[model samples]
Target: MKPSTSSFNEVKKAIVLLSGGLDSATVLAIATAQGYECHTMSFDYGQRHRSELDAAVRIAEQFHAKTHRVMQMNMNAIGGSALTDMDIAVPTGGLSETVPITYVPARNTVFLSYALALAEVVGALDIFIGVNAVDYSGYPDCRPEYIAAFETMANLATQAALEGHKVKIQTPLIHLSKAEIIQQGVALGVDYAKTVSCYQANSEGLACGQCDSCLLRKQGFREAGLDDPTPYAI
Candidate 1:
């Protein structure tokens, strides 16, 4: 459903980080459901699966976001992760306790910094991100403590916050399992088929069905008792 149209002065604006993944798509739905004039942002930071960038565009249109911006940067220059560096292989093995090699260095931090800037310019007090500590690969930046720390820094670092406006970093999926996240998204009428969650998605946005991301997404659909509409290359 589309967010209700309101006058600019009465609009409740929010900047949503849309990665063209299941979680980010769900977060966009949540922000829309909350009656926010959503401005979605996606990054094309030299990721191997550039198909997700296309997916991001589709998702923003599907959700009827007020605005969608794609920022281009070269994270591959400092790449230690398999996602940004084609040389490093995506792990098909099961999840691990330690941080995986798939983790992009300071990715959320960089994304949030950009979001904070956009929020200031758009007069959006809330910045929505779909970071989950539960049902995720071991990414340090996805933790609750990290989000909290960043929110504190955002308030201190922004001109909007200096003028008595507080910036909130909203992570609605932070505490929810993948199953719960899927359920929420389905309830909000999110089209899972439009989202690409696989770390090594093909040019057509088809999942590899072997990477850590694909495994988690599969499990989430199974647990949610929903048929996964994600197109798989396997």
Candidate 2:
């Protein structure tokens, strides 16, 4: 039941995973520019920082995304990852050999599942996710192979693909490094200040400069030679 992978026709409608992060926001911009009528999906997955949801909403509005769904996936009820568990300490240092404690458990899988459902309901043929492998070495879901596999699975599982139309999973930021992604966003006129990337941001929306998210942001801006306007308390 495998559908053709190569030569996928460009889809007109797309659903983007807008997490209020820099990468997703940039991806949304790319999708909009491509003339896809964008629909955005965000989750309240019990992460430490819910402020990102606000950012997600604002980003979706800027793009005039046709629909923005904020589903509640209670990953907190499982209680394994650092994002869901309060006891584990957030990592401070830069890149590591293995995945970091902040890696959420099968987060992309769950998010994509919801996106698939929503896309089918709306007859959207493309899904956009911002998963960067080169820049984010710690997350398993950000790997290229994993995303490719997911694309294959989507083709097989979906009725739309079986019926002849192609379903695409777009990862515009996958091949790009954080610096390159930032550069692309800058060129696209993305308002970086609206995105949030802090694992431990305060209620006042101040980033903890020590967390892995903050460290990566620091490195990305440094590499791109761009200043991040998002507030950081450090």
| lDDT winner | 1
Candidate 1: pairs in clash: none
**lDDT of candidates 1 onward, in order:** 0.92, 0.85
Among the numbered candidates, top TM-score falls to 1
Judge candidate 2 against the unseen true structure and give its global Cα lDDT, from 0 to 1. Answer: 0.85
Return the clash pairs for model 2, or none: none
Across residues 43-85, which tens digit of lDDT does each residue of candidate 1 receive?
9998997888888899999989999999999999999999989
TM-score of each: 0.96, 0.92
- Clashes counted in candidate 1 amount to 0
